[model samples]
Target chain A: MAEDHKMTYADPWMLPETKGFWEALNDGKLVIRTCNDCGRGHHFPRAMCPHCYSSNLEWKESDGTGTIYSFTAQQVKGGGKYVYAYVEIADRVRAITNIVDCDPDALQIGQKVKAAFRPSASGQNILVFTPA
Target chain B: MTAHDARLVGAYELPYRHAPDKSLAQMQAEAALGAVADAGLSLKDVDGFFCGGDTPGMGPMSLIEYLNITPRYVDSTETGGNSYVSHVARAARAIDAGLCDVALITLAGKPRTPAKGSRPMTDSNKPDQDFELTYHPTVPANYALAAQRHMYEYGTTSEQLAWIKVAASHHAQHNPHALLKDVVTVEDVVNSPMVASPLHRFDCCVITDGGGALILAKSEIAKRLNRPSVKILGTGEAVKHQGAGDIDLTWTAGKWAAEKAWKMSGCTPDQIQYASIYDSFTITVLLEIEDLGFCKPGHGGGFVAEGNLISGKGKLPFNTDGGGLCSNHPGNRGGMTKVIEAVRQLRGEAHPAVQVPDCALALAHGTGGSLGTRHGASTLILARED
Candidate 1:
């Protein structure tokens, strides 16, 4: 994908605990942090399980198959247009992302989607989604 | 002092179109002074101060100095637009606890003004900022997410949501100072340029430069004032967020807030003649109506369709002053005006064309932040004191 197509938003201000999540995306794979203590998973890789407050967390590669929970295309006046959505991925964990390589208008809730790694403004591979 | 012992003796929404010449402080100070004088009370009478994020400088300290009045008690809770709404509960409790006799709550903002370059209020360093901001999650983006989920969940349509903006336009036509007074139609709303899918440009509220203020006094002070006082019957506030990724986007925390306010006020939805629901977007009013118990959760589409929220024409007259949708949204916050309009309805001081008949009881509610994510909800119930 061309660099100009990425969202105008700035790159992620990474933290130590969540660095591996972004690194995996750069390698064209998606990852979710899972709580070893409670068997729950979370996205955007947190230090602890938000569900159970357990610090027993580990990196787990995800197949990146998901269903679009809700989606909307933001068309900024005189600016770029992109579709951002919450896709229920990694066993129902909602991941914030954009739906790329597809028609924004054709997207629907509950539509099946798969990961598409695209270059972000900072040249990091950002994980987006497209119709599977 | 007892619960519900505070009465709104004064409320003033600056007759705002645009104030490019005014500083944020000037707007807020003028609003503060306006309410003080409206209550027939002197500036000396304000011994308590309540403010939110819109206020310039460090909390209320700078504003207190700018106003040149010393308030012995103060609260500077900043919950976006819901700050002023929640301030009402804080001010009333402070007054009841003898923290202050006369309390002044103020809000001012200039978001509509062309920016001279400034950063957002929230730092980009928040834990979730990096994760969310990169997705281009603008204000409309967040609400559009909820709007889309709502449509999918309850078979809601773009046309049904357009009715909300249509109703607001009808009421705005009666308000000369309304930012949009042309009286738009449902078709017009649905056809407006789409800024965010499930949300047309017309479905969104106008961004305007203006401010408003409120004055709450102890019941005795209110009785002494010559102005008609609106008694604060009940107040409730709640917060909502995506609970551990089990996020629900269809409804807001407004249900929880409304329930608490209803239980406190001992009043039901049937008793409210007028409503000042925050209209950040047309979809917001829809969800709020359902959450406030005006109708069941999924029935909001039908409840607002066919001109259900238009003043003097619908079952409930909402946002007669046009709300944040048509009227000015100072500081880009919608909470202060909701409280101000409710007070106007309760005092029978609203524009006569849109005023509710009898106008005995009214409700004002505010939702701050975004519906798609973490947000605060506040609700207030007020009644006329004969």
Candidate 2:
């Protein structure tokens, strides 16, 4: 894994609005932004609902359960083999995350997965998925 | 006839794959001179200017100030690789509105050896960087995510996707300046190293230094000039995103752009003698081919298999100049080269080996930004008027 020489933050820079989500992740709890109006959910949490544009959004705790919507393990030239995937979390929120604790080649679509916090190469707690 | 119509009277592509000594401005000027002269016009004749973010100094003025001519109109729309193709539609609309007489659009890039600090891995201030950057959204990986979903939804196979690269290699053999001139087969592609799961190394486009220019003149100027008339029949551009989380990874926004183009030109896919679909990746062509209405949805894989896109062999010939997959795609923003090749095919100036015979109507398309994330797509339908 190569690092961009210019990155200022080894860990995520949390904004006031996103503080709750980041704090929850570090606390060994997972959460998603749920819309009160539409009863739908989204990831990369935002203040307003992406589906209905309603400001009545709340952070609901998730059990880290989801299905593998799609995935690709990229092998860069002279670089590490990385497994990136889209996990369709419960409540219809699709999350793009890395898969861990398993062989990269063994991943498949429609498989069950559960989110877990693991240390990345940069020595920061990161979200990843494993075969449930 | 309305005085607003425009004709592409000049087209020029620089003959270089790696020009480390030349700066972006130098390449732009060289290609600009070649295009303007090819149109039987001079720099003084250019009254409108257009460029993309690749322009170095200051917006479109990097070239505008360098050439020392103040155009009556200017447009600096940036859509990554698709910017140049979108500029074609913008220039035509500007000319139709009597905004300018000669619209000159130029593109030049040197991604093979970028200037230090010019290529940043991540924008520190981009709003979503904190969320999406962690997943390692490398260019091919982002697209591979889409390929995976397409395979799941439509059953698109790697072999079917390999045909696109096969088509580009088939045409690249005819191009003297193409970077990868050797022809490749489906077996060769699938057997190559896998850069991303489902997308082998052959599935990606080559990165090379390149620059190309196009001069669209008022119809009257085109008539007086000695160049063949390449009419701008119709053009359309659109941006597609995740649609508020209701995203379908298999589809692209190109469908909307193509609809607008087809409605404006009154030309269906069957009437198009030559097609220049952008080739950022193999799956890109499959999606665009289906989106452009050349085949039914989910049928592009079968439509392109079995040498169906080769010049003399297939009913629909595409990328006779090798496209981005084999030839030059300046700065990796390939939209400019798409239109350049379409003009070549329309003018009968393509290489003798791959030239489409009596190419009367041609379509050139481009997709830029990231296909997985938010991106832009453009479509242009051109004609060689009798």
Best by DockQ: 1
The DockQ value obtained for model 1 is 0.70
Weakest 10 consecutive residues of candidate 2 chain B by summed lDDT:
B241-250
Which candidate leads the pack in lDDT?
1
List of chain A TM-scores, every candidate: 0.87, 0.82
Model 1 C-alpha lDDT per residue in residues A1-132, reported as the tens digit of each score? 211244554666678888888899888888888899989887667788988898988888889889999999888667667888999986658878888877787788999999987776777877788899
* Candidate 2: tens digits of C-alpha lDDT, residues B155-200: 8999999999999999999899999999999999999899878899
Q: Taking the candidates in order, what DockQ does each have?
A: 0.70, 0.53
Error of 2 at B368 (Å): 0.4
Could you tell me the lDDT of residue B239 within candidate 1?
Answer: 94
Each prediction's TM-score versus the true structure: 0.96, 0.95
Off by more than 4 A, model 1: A1-9, B1-3, B114-117, B120-124
**Clash number for each model:** 1, 0
Tens digits of lDDT, candidate 2, A1-132: 222111122476655677778777788778888889988888777878888899998889888888888888878566657677878876556777777665677777889998888754455566777789
